[model samples]
Target: MLTPTGEIVAEARRLGVGAGAFNVITVEHAEAVVSGAEAAGCAVILQISENAVRFHHGRLAPIAAAARAVAELSTVAVGLHLDHVESDELFDQAAANGFGSAMYDASKLEYADNVAATACAVARGHAAGLWVESELGEVGGKDGAHKPGVRTNPAEAAAFVQSTGVDALAVAVGSSHAMTNRDARLDHELIELLHDAVSVPLVLHGSSGVPDDELRAAVRGGLVKINIGTALNIAFTGAIRAAIAQDVTVVDPRKYLRTARHDMAETVTKALRVLTGATP
Candidate 1:
């Protein structure tokens, strides 16, 4: 059923478990995420990125509404989250479009500017009764300004949350964004230190780059929210390729899409089991 992000995440914190926040770009992604969560008997967050909004020609309302409906109807608790939104207008759009929570990515800005902008977003999101998450420092492995060695400081992270009043904080703990391979090594020591220092929940971005064993360990080490994107993209693209190779004459969208969705669902389920330690 549809629930507040704070409620879902707070329960996770209490239970010593992390919630999977999968990025969604299509209807199939949404279906597979919900199905995976239900199958795992765990709550999940379905996220739509700023890039996704741009891909859909700026019409996020319909897409967000559909995701929200799926979350509302799911057997397990689910949250519709807007990810990496930089503008207040975008955050406003997401809040109005039925998103339960959102992350405003002001990491590209200067430290003070990022803090100010994120604070504004937090205020607006709280006013709308939506949970807000923000990134302090940068996660490496992406084309962004942050380099791989630039890790978030524990003291800085704690201060950022205290000043901004956000529900969660995404800190750089050694994982990079959009990594196709699972070779990134996380500083488990840093993760534990940050967890001890920060009162808010810790979010791990670019988790797709981390191996399955490391992911489970990160959660065990106190990371609360894991954001995965590239792995799902890999499953989706690989399934499409496999389906096309098997039937060269099949041109129907449903034929290949059905195969892709099934593959994606299995991938999600596998990730859920590893990260959340949930078993059927």
Candidate 2:
């Protein structure tokens, strides 16, 4: 069943649990997430990032359509979300395309500018009845704000949410993006402080780098929405690489793609268990 991201996040926050928001680069990724969610009997978010739109030649309609179709067909609850979107035009398209939620990323701008841009975005998203999310700090990856010590100030975070009226907030707290290794240490105490300071659900980006025990600990501290991307890419790419390497003569793409999708699904199920504190 297709579910609203706000509903899922709200439930998780209310129950003091974590909601998994897994990024999707292709249709298979979305399918695998839903499949894993069904196996775990949990609701999962399907996130499509701005980079993915660029990968598809700056077109979001096709990928958005594919995700919606997959979500509608799934037995488990699924929510479609646009992740790390910085363009107003693209953000507009999210609501036009029937996305239940979107994260308007203006964290790259100066503090005041980010708040101004994000506030306007929140108003626009709210007008379209979309649950809006904005990032306060750069969750360290790529360039700029990649420093390991950078973390979101609980006082500043509370002010940003208050000024922007965003439905949720993603704060930097030690994790960096695109980390293949899962050794990132999160500030558990800061997470608790931010949770107490902010009125809305807290989102943790760059969560792929956080270990399972840390993830469970983060949830216990106050993270409601957990964003994961690189881990799936790692799982998918690794499985495909191994399958192809083992059989040099195999030429069919489906043979290897099947293994990749299955492996990714397994990863999602395990992550869900950790976030929800279920016995794996």
Candidate 3:
């Protein structure tokens, strides 16, 4: 069933669990994410990032349409979200194209400027009845420019959310984006502080850097939404490599693509289990 992002977040809040949001670059990715959610009997979010739109020549309609189709056809609840979108135009496009939620990222700008931009985006998204997410500080891995010690101030985070009226807040504690290793240590105390200070749900970006145990701990400490990308890509591509290596003469795209999709689905299922504290 197709679900709104706000509803998904509310469920996570009610259950005291973290909702997993997976980035989808292709139709296969969308299908795999939904399949994983169904396997876990949990709801999941399907996210399309600005980088993915750029990869598709700035066109969001096609991918958004495909994700919507997949979500509607799936048995488990699914929400479509636009992740880390910096441009107003693209954000508007995402809302128009049926994305139930969007993360307006203006973290590169000065503090006040980022707030103003994100506020405007929030208003626009609200007008379209879309759940809005925004980041306070840089969440690291922005082309390797993030400082290791940069963390979101709890007071500033509360102020930002009050000012922007965003539905969710992505805070920088210690995780960095695009991390290949899942060793980033999160500040459990800071997560609790932010959760207490902010009125909305707290989101953890660059969650791929945090290992499974740390992720469960983060959830227990107060994180609500977890955005994962690199780990799934690693699982997907690794399966493709293994498939090709296993059959040197195989040329059919479906043969290898099937394995890639299945592997990604398994990864998402495991992640959901961890985030929701389900027994494996």
Of 1 and 2, the candidate ahead on lDDT is 2
Model 3 ranges off by over 4 Å = none
Every model: Cα RMSD to truth: 1.2, 1.0, 1.0
Tens-place lDDT digits, model 2, residues 1-280 = 7789999999988888899999999988998898888899888999999989989899999999999999999888899999999889999999888699999999878999999999999999999989999998778885564555678999999999999999999988888989999999999999999989999999999999999989999999999999999999999999999998999899999999999999999999999988888888
Model 1 scores a TM of: 0.97
Candidate 1 on 1-59: residue-level lDDT in tens?
Answer: 98778788888888888888999999888988888888888888899999888888988
Residue 52 CA displacement from its true place in model 1, Å? 0.6
Cα error, candidate 2, residue 271 (Å): 0.3
- In the predicted model 1, the residue pairs found to clash are none
Task: Flag regions of model 1 displaced more than 4 Å.
Answer: none
Candidate 2: segments with Cα more than 4 A from true spot: 144-147
- Which residue pairs in candidate 2 collide? none
Relative to the true structure, candidate 3 has a C-alpha RMSD (angstroms) of 1.0
**Count of clashes, each model:** 0, 0, 0
Each model's lDDT comes to: 0.87, 0.91, 0.92
